[model samples]
Structure formats: structure tokens, C-alpha cells
Target chain A: MKNLVLASTSTLHGQEYLEYLLPLIKSHFRDCSKILFIPYARPGGISHEDYTATAGKAFEKAGLQVHGIHEFDSPHEAVKQADGFFTGGGNTFLLVQQLYRNDLLPALKEAINKGVAYLGTSAGTNIAGLSMKTTNDMPIVYPPSFNTLGIVPFNINPHYLDPDPASTHKGETRETRIREFHSHNPQPVVGLREGSWLEVKGKNIKLKGDLTARIFEAGKEAFEVEPETLLNDLN
Target chain B: MKNLVLASTSTLHGQEYLEYLLPLIKSHFRDCSKILFIPYARPGGISHEDYTATAGKAFEKAGLQVHGIHEFDSPHEAVKQADGFFTGGGNTFLLVQQLYRNDLLPALKEAINKGVAYLGTSAGTNIAGLSMKTTNDMPIVYPPSFNTLGIVPFNINPHYLDPDPASTHKGETRETRIREFHSHNPQPVVGLREGSWLEVKGKNIKLKGDLTARIFEAGKEAFEVEPETLLNDLN
Candidate 1:
């Protein structure tokens, strides 16, 4: 059985870091006494130690002891030993690069597949997908590869925003960028807006939260799926 | 005598494609009679031929003959013989991938350095910079390298937008992403607004158009440079 909570964002507008997801996280990691935190995706260029402390502070409310992988002698060993894991949000390119550099992606993937409880937000959630191609993050660093954990059958576009009909910005919209991805890649993409997430248990994946997510299948029109919709068939 | 007009966008909102930059482009390519168009960065999943025709239509008004690199028997030969070049906007990853795949990057760079008239918009303009690290496009495809032409010393964030203070969106703003880039990369980044561009003549580079471009230097605060300001010293 696989247990995972992949969210679009760690913090919502006007909310504290991971505050809105605390209730769900408490129940999700209920069985684990310690949670290993992967702080490679340093949001706002935060240091690993500082980022880990932030996560530790948030998880304290759930009575979960948190340790950052960076603090360990071996990140690969840390992944194998942890009962639960949490990866925070930042630049997806940097996160992916660091994961490859430390050579912990395989161990992390295997741990998640072995049913270790896992939590991912934004850049973290983007890596849970088949590839990081649909990530909205800038390519600040060149990663060795775009391939990810493949825990999810499809790719995820985190912090997805709908095009503002009244706006005049000429940059490619979230919708347009995903469409471009489908042009060269065959994977379906889920546009997970802020405050929404995918809850995966075993082989069952359900869309969680109140808002509907935008679904994009290659060569097909983008459609919306409501919360609680099973997304296992997307692969 | 490098003649180049690297624009932020090919089209402005409510304007025809490449409409806003026509006057500048015409003067930029005035000495050339033929223009070779590279349409590998196909916007909206448009076919290569269709994208080429679109460029042809726009350049026809300037009384210059237009032909896509794809139409030539040998793209390398076409580049060597062309007096002017136009690389239109689309996906930066795809454009770079194709440039490497066709082994045309070296040839294109050589031609540009030899004083061939060159015009780039969006993804095209992105490649004119040192690297595509600051590009806002999705990673639709994996390119051989993030390295680019480096015709200009700094990286470019085309269609650069300012943070909307009133918006509640949780997505990382353009400024945050660039700041993140600085943490990993040392290159300075120019945030070129839609109507702004960098006009490079020989070793002299100047910000053009009506808007003041945002400049981000590594380990320093981002600042603004007015139009006609020389940017040659940024490197």
C-alpha cells in the first residue's frame, strides 16, 4: 500500500505556512512517530537548516518529531529509516537537481512505494508525478533528468491558476503552458490549484479539498474534476 | 556590427502578431533582402510549416523574402547563406532542443556574430541571453543543454511582469523566481516588459522602447533602467 498527500501549495493566500493543511496532515501521519523532512526545495532561498526548522515548528502541533535529511550522515539511509516523509515547496528545478546530486531519488521512491507515509507540497508534489515537465517553477538549475518518482501516473501542475479573462498579461497562461507540454510529451496533467491536493492510499487516488481541479489530457480539451474524484484512471 | 533586436514578446495584447515591433524590425533588417525563420518553438502546438507561414506573412510587409529553416535541404547551409534571421516565440525548451538536434546552434551563433541581422521574440529572445534559466516557459521537452547563444551578457525574463499587490494568488511572483535563480546561478537577469527590448549593435547593448526594464544582479537588489540606457556593462 502507498500513502501520500500531494498538495498544490504549502501556504495559501493570507495563511501561515502549512496552516491550512494541518488538520489533514495530523490524520495522514498519525501512525508515524517521526517524520523525515526533505528541505532541498528551499522556498525564497532559505537555508536547509532554517527550512527544516520551519517544518519542524509546524509538525510539532501534530506531535510528530521532525528531522531534516540534510542533518543525517546519509540522506539515502535517512529515507530508508524514516516512517514518514515531508518534502516542502520551492523551485522544482533546484529540488530535482539536489535529489539527483545526493542520489536519494531511488531510495525515496522505493520508500514511498513500500507504504511509508509521504507528504508533498508544490515542488514536492510536482516530483510525485511521472515527470517534472509540467512544473511552473523557473529552471534556475539544470537537473540531470526530468523523470521523477512516478508515484502518480500523470504529471501535476502545482499552484495552478486559471487565466484571468480581464487581464492583459501576454505571457503563456497555465493552461497554454500545459497544452505546450502535451505537444511534445504524452502525459496527462492535473492542474492542482492552491488549497487543493491529491490523497493517494494504496492504488486509490482521490482529489481532495473543496475546489475543482483542471484536468488536461493530451489532444483533448481541458476539463474540470470535482473534489473526491478518483484519478487513478488518468494513467 | 552585430545587428539584433531581442524583444520581450512578438505580440502585444490586442495587437497583431509582431505588430508592436514591426517598425523596429524593419529598420533592424533593412540591409538584408532575405530572412530565414526558425519555427521550432511552435506556439499552441502549431505545425512547423504553419508557424513559418505566419512569420512569412508578417515579414512580407517589410519587403523581405522569408523562408523557414525546415524548408531548406540543409539547415546549416541555409544559415550560412542567410543575410537575416528571425526566431519566433514559443517553447524555449523545444527551440533549444531543435537547435541542438539539428546542430544549428554553432552555425546560428557564428552567423549572428558575423553581423547577420537577427530578430528574436519571447523564447527566441531568451536564447539570445547567456542561458534559458530565466525563461518562464514550461519544460515541455528536455533539451540537450540550458546554454544558449549568449549574444547578450545577461539572462532575459521576457514578458516580465510586476507583482500585482492586490492579487491573492499564492503562486511565486516573477521577482521571487528570479531571486531564486540568483541563489543558484550568478548571471544577472533583465526583466523585459512586453513592449521593451534589447537592441544590440556590435558590443553596445541598450534597453529600448517606452518602459523601464527591471534589472536583477546576483547578490544585489533588483533595480530599474530606463529606455536607451546602455546595458553593455552588465556582464
Candidate 2:
């Protein structure tokens, strides 16, 4: 029974984001005193030590010890030594690529199943899904499509936005992109706009975001859901 | 071999677009007595008659006979009688939906194999590929993913453009979107800007446009090619 807190970065440091995440981390690891930071995703070309240092500072400011995974030779050792792991957001594609290149997806899945608190943001949020097809970023790089950790059944489209009228360039809107993804895919996708997240506490999965998050199941109308709605079975 | 000219419009009857397509059609089909308009794709939701009229009028002004496929109940027969066929621009997702629903893809493939001469614009251009995954439109509707006529090995991303600087909105750019597509896709995709076209003549596949086209192949740098370089491939 572990609590996972996935968050979009407010800034690079734990100091900036730790306030938002500290309570949740403390609630899960009442006896533990430290949080581990995973920075292997930086090699995917998005995150760097300068970026990760900010994340470390956020946790340190929260009065929690933080360790970078880069210190370990393998993700398994990092996970084993930590009470809970926090995966910060950078580029999900790049993150997954690094995990895949190092053959860590299986180990991460095992850790999650064994009750390692799993937290992610942005691109990290994408890897929680069955596939990364729903991601809104450009696939400027290639990663193993099947390498997702599968903590969540539906795909996560992070940084989702409503259409803006000020823009005149004519093309498909973000909602249209998600709809198109659903049209081609048989799986459900959760379009999580910024400031929104999905929280899993034991067997309970709660939608923690704005007024409503968009949910699209294959061949069905995409509907909005409040925080109280049942989304665990959405996939 | 039959000469094919896929146009962005069918009739250009009353629109200003005729000025752009009329001369091209006349010059390309100078030897042909008639041009067949495939209107079956209209049922997919885009206004068909308007598109047809646009093309029909342009041909008529050039003193060429323009016949709509509706003239015959069976498209197979229409293909047999056609000197060359012009497919107009519309929602390619909808067009392919209709093509799949009516089982017209195989029939059209047969017709093209017989050298009946096929020309498609927009949605029509999409179906001239190995698959339609590269289309820029939203598949708000579901369509069958089946074998296209195979005139090209990759999908055509029509109306492709770089992000407009004058606009203000936060999201992934078109370049990023195409890059995301290539990240997950193993096949190559050709991003064809508006007013640009791919002409397949015999063993030749040439790109015709005012600007460079972006070509994305999985695991390679997305490169740009001038019209001249692409034209060389036509032979």
C-alpha cells in the first residue's frame, strides 16, 4: 500500500515542487526519511544535472534527503535502496528511450508491482500508460514503443490544452489530436491538461486536477470527469 | 501508360482556385478527351458537390469534358470508362472512411494497376500511400487502416507548414508533431507543404513545389529537399 505522487514541474528543484509533493511523500513513507531522484532520463537529451539539481533542492528544502540515480550503476540498485522514487518530468520520449536503452523497464515494472511508490510528471506521466502514442510531443527521437512501465492502463497525453483562438494557423487542434489518437487506437486515453494529475493511493485512483479531465474510450464520445469520478477502470 | 493528375479541386467552377489548377490540368491532360471525377469520397462528410463543381468548371472552361462518378452506379465501370481520374481535396480521414466502407480501395487499386491514370489531392493524396498515418487531419471519425494503392512507400502529410511566428499559442509545433510521428513510426513520411505535390510518372517520383519538403525516416535526421532534388527522383 504505497502512495504515488506524479506532478508537473513548477521549477527544476525539489524546493519548488517539494511543497506540492512533500505531504504525499511523507504520507507514504512515514518511517522513511529520504526520497530518491531518478535522472537517467537526462541522457535522452532533455534533462541535465543543472535541471536535476533544482529537483534535488526542492526535496532538500522539504527536509527530505535526495539522492540522484546517476550515482548507482543500475536503476534496480537505486530502487532497492530507496523508500520511494520520484521521476521528474523532462521529455517522456527521451526518458523512455534511456530506460529502454539500459533495459530498465522490466525492473521498474517489478519495483512498481512490489509496492515502490512511483511518481512521474510530463513525459514521465506518458510512460505510466500502456503506450506513448498519445503523447503530444514530437517524436524527434525513437524509443521502444512497448517499453512503457504500464502502471496505468490508458495512455496519458500530458500538457493537454484547449484550442486557442488567437492563433490563425489552420491545422488540427489538441482535442482533435487526442480524438484522432482514439480513432486509430482501440485503447482509452486520458487527456490530462496542465495542473492536473492522477493519484493512486493503494487500490484507489483519483483524478486530481481542474474541473474536469477528458477521457476517450474507443468508439465513444469523449467526456469530462470530475475528481470524484471513477477512473480506475477507464482502461 | 496513363497520365495521372490528382488535383486539389474537381470543378474550380466558381472559385478563385481555378486560376491555380486549370492550366495545370489542361496542360497535363492535353491528349485526354475527358476527366473522371471520383465523388464517392464525399459521403464521408466533406461537401462533395462543391469540390466536384470546382474541378468540373475548371475543366469545362478549358473545353474538356468533366464527368462525375455519380454518372455511374458502379465505380468499377466508372474507372473503366475514365481517361484519367481526379481526386479532390477534403478530409482525408473521411474520404478513407468512405473508401473503406464502400470497399473502393481494392477496386481503385485495381484501376490504378491497369494504368487508368489516377490523380488525388489532399485526402486523395493520402490514399496514394502505403498507409494514412501521416495525414495532418484529425481522424474524428474511424477509418479502416488498409493497403493503399501503393503509389508511394510512405504517407503524405499534406498542407504541412512550420509554426507561424505571428501566432501566439503554447503547444508542440507542426515540426514537432511530424517528429513525434516519426519517432514511433518505422516508415518514412513526406511532409508536403501546400501548393507542393508528388508526381509519380512511370518509374519516376518527383516532388513539385515552391519550397523544400521535409522528409522523416525513422532513426535518421529529418532533412529538407528542394524541388529540383525531389524532381530527380521522378525519373
Highest TM-score: give the candidate number: 1
- Highest DockQ among the candidates is held by which one? 1
| Model 1 pairs whose backbones collide | none
Off by over 4 Å in 2: A7-44, A47-54, A57-71, A90-94, A141-144, A164-170, B1-170, B175-235
Model 1's CAPRI class is high
- Which CAPRI quality tier does the interface of model 2 achieve? incorrect
Which 10 consecutive positions of candidate 1 chain B have the poorest summed lDDT? Answer: B57-66
lDDT of each: 0.93, 0.63
RMSD of each: 0.9, 7.4
Candidate 1: stretches off by over 4 Å: none
* Chain A of model 1 scored by TM-score: 0.98
